[model samples]
Target: MNLTTTAKPIVIIGAGIAGVHAAETLRNEGYEGRIVLVDRDTQLPYDRPPLSKEFILGELSEADISLRSNESLTALRIELKLGVEIVSIDAKKKIAISSDDEILEWEKLLLTTGSSLRKLQVKGSDLEGIHYLKTLSDAKAIRQKLDGIQQVAIVGAGFIGAELASSFKKQGKEVTILERMPLPLAHILGEEMGEYFLQLHQSEGVHVITEDAVVQFDGTTQVEKALTEKGRIIPCQAVIVGIGVIPNTFLSDKELHVDRGYIVNEFGETSLPNVYAAGDCAMWPYRGDNIHIEHWDHAVNHGKCVAKNLLGGEPISYTAIPYFWSDQYDHRIQYFGHTKNWDSAVLQGNMEDKQFTYFYLNESGVIDAALLVNQPKNALAVRRLIKQQQSVDSDLLSNPEVNLKNVHVQENEDKVSY
Candidate 1:
């Protein structure tokens, strides 16, 4: 698809990974038309995964996590408008109004607004020491505050909370994670895996409190203690809440189809013609369901996939498999595929050894997902099995002698029926 030089610029909102990748993909795909990337943040687009780990641990500087430098973006002919936001959009006119009231005309529009961190709304929520890690500035504030505080309390046991707990423990601070669930990550990874993580944190001298919810925070200026629902009081000088995030859909009008997120097809095309949305803010069709994934890899791939559809030609369907990883206390957790319901979870190794793989299978005995803990070598093989949707012997999957690469059962072979 050839775009004329006189064509209007392609306007992409949100200068995070999704928007940056889309702009870069447009240039790489030979689009000569102008491309403008707008973002509300003043800082250059940077990697977000490190904000809770390396950035908080002081191992990586601001420049180190930058996705692209100004010179690099300039060379690609991608104009970046930082510290600007698209307040509203007129879908019929193909124009967007910015926060400063500057109107932008676009040949095509891509919304990658991403997500915002959810805030705790209990008593004393306005305390000065309570923080949420979502952006660079948030991480910077937490890092700066860590210098004067020793007792650190994390409100959730999700990925962000776990990673922050690991970072805080590394600094020799008294870290305690308060989770409302009976076992951390039980809803996602099941109770067995959640118990494994609970042990992992306790073994590192970090206090793990489960089945308790913080009802109020008691402090005059800063958070001094957290009051729980079960009459438990946790004394802490600082708090970090990582409950979850909500997709940014404030710019979408009523005319646009909106569910949990901006509903889009496999091509990433929204309800409005010539308008598209990707990343966390868009819910695209996956398998048989419309799901929204808020991970770095999905955002990058979804942006690139949507960029191809921006050009008026054959549309490319987004079919990338979901993958995400977390680093906590010398152990790396890598997950491939996505499934909220699984019939059985087959364990590959001993959980006590801190090296294992849990294969989640559906009722059809097909591999739905796999989680690897400190087993990097089996990641590729597990991903392939899940992508192939192959069924294997559960005994072989649990056997330490059997390699994952050779566990694929062909037709006519007796396999474990779930």
Candidate 2:
């Protein structure tokens, strides 16, 4: 958590939450080095999740999204370069070439370019009325178009699409979500729990359409309707695609082993020395799989761990349990750890009751992954189970009479929710 070094110019690309926080953490760690922050956006780093939720709901404004005030940025004595893009990185030369044709050599480079929203590969996708939420400008565009809008079609049933549907429904918009999979959130939460989400959205009065692909958009000059694979037409003034995201790595070449995202080790180190990648753009090992996490918390935490490595700290591997959450309507869904390797599941509480935690247990009886709906407290013990590799008794997990407080499912049951 502490980094103190006299390194000459630490350059951070993409002023996102990860980049900004890493810089802040560096200063907190007593490091008095020069931190130059570069970003392609005109505005400073802001929260992206609220853009589809509270921001669109009118509970928060654009300014509320800013992570730090002008005073804070100025007082930090950090160089802020906004609306600038990094053209490429010469790792061997330890220099970063900017779009404006300025090359700055860095003692250490932190790449945090983040992810780009995946676009619908359908016709009329380039139309004016279609949008995706990935940046402040994107959120602004959608908010402007939402004036008196009646119907909104959201493509994909992932976190972003689901959250948007919830927000749109709250704003009295006729929200319809279309998913190509038979079950919503199947790849993330599994089909059983994905259907539960389908029911959850349906109960909230949102039209949940599954097993349907948006074939094309219908309009002359702008998007007026959505043409589904089922040959059904849904009237809409706007369409938001939230299928997922692709890593933004146009600047880096194979010298860093860039796949969809930059490939990194357990400590967030890339193939090139003195260069580290974090957040959505870096792929690290997850449950024996080299995966890229797109969640905000993961990005922030990864930034901290990577900063430690860059500051000449002890060899600490970046190995936090992967976790993600989604706020849809009045319900909040949070998942932790891996589920793909689980052979069995222990269900606690009633899905019909709409408040329960489903824990996926591996053949070894250790809780591998968990999905919690409405109940936020369950993630506390479940995360423990995942870390400790403890053998779970199905009765203790599923039985309402059984006290989980006395039972240690993970390494430590006393650990609380984050």
lDDT of each: 0.91, 0.83
The digit string of per-residue lDDT tens for model 2 on 174-284 reads 999999998888886777887788888899898888888998998988789999988989899889988888998887666778888889999888888888889989989
lDDT tens readout by residue for model 1, 1-418: 5555556799999999999999999999999889999999999999999999999989999999999999999999999999998899998898999988999999899999999988889999999899999989999999999886999999999999999999999999999999999998989898888888898999999999999999999999989999999999899999999999999998877779989789999999999988899999999998899988999999999999999889867889998889999999999999899899999889989887889899999987788888999999998888778877766767778889887776564667545332
Candidate 2 Cα outliers beyond 4 Å, as residue runs: 1-7, 409-418
TM-score, model 2 to reference:
0.94
The TM-scores of all predictions, comma-separated, are: 0.96, 0.94
Angstrom error of the Cα, residue 83, model 1: value is 1.0
Number of residue pairs clashing in candidate 2, backbone atoms closer than 3 angstroms, sequence gap of 3 or more or interchain: 2
* Stretches of candidate 1 exceeding 4 Å from the true structure: 2-6, 408-418
- Model 1 TM-score on a 0 to 1 scale: 0.96
Model 1, CA-based lDDT: 0.91
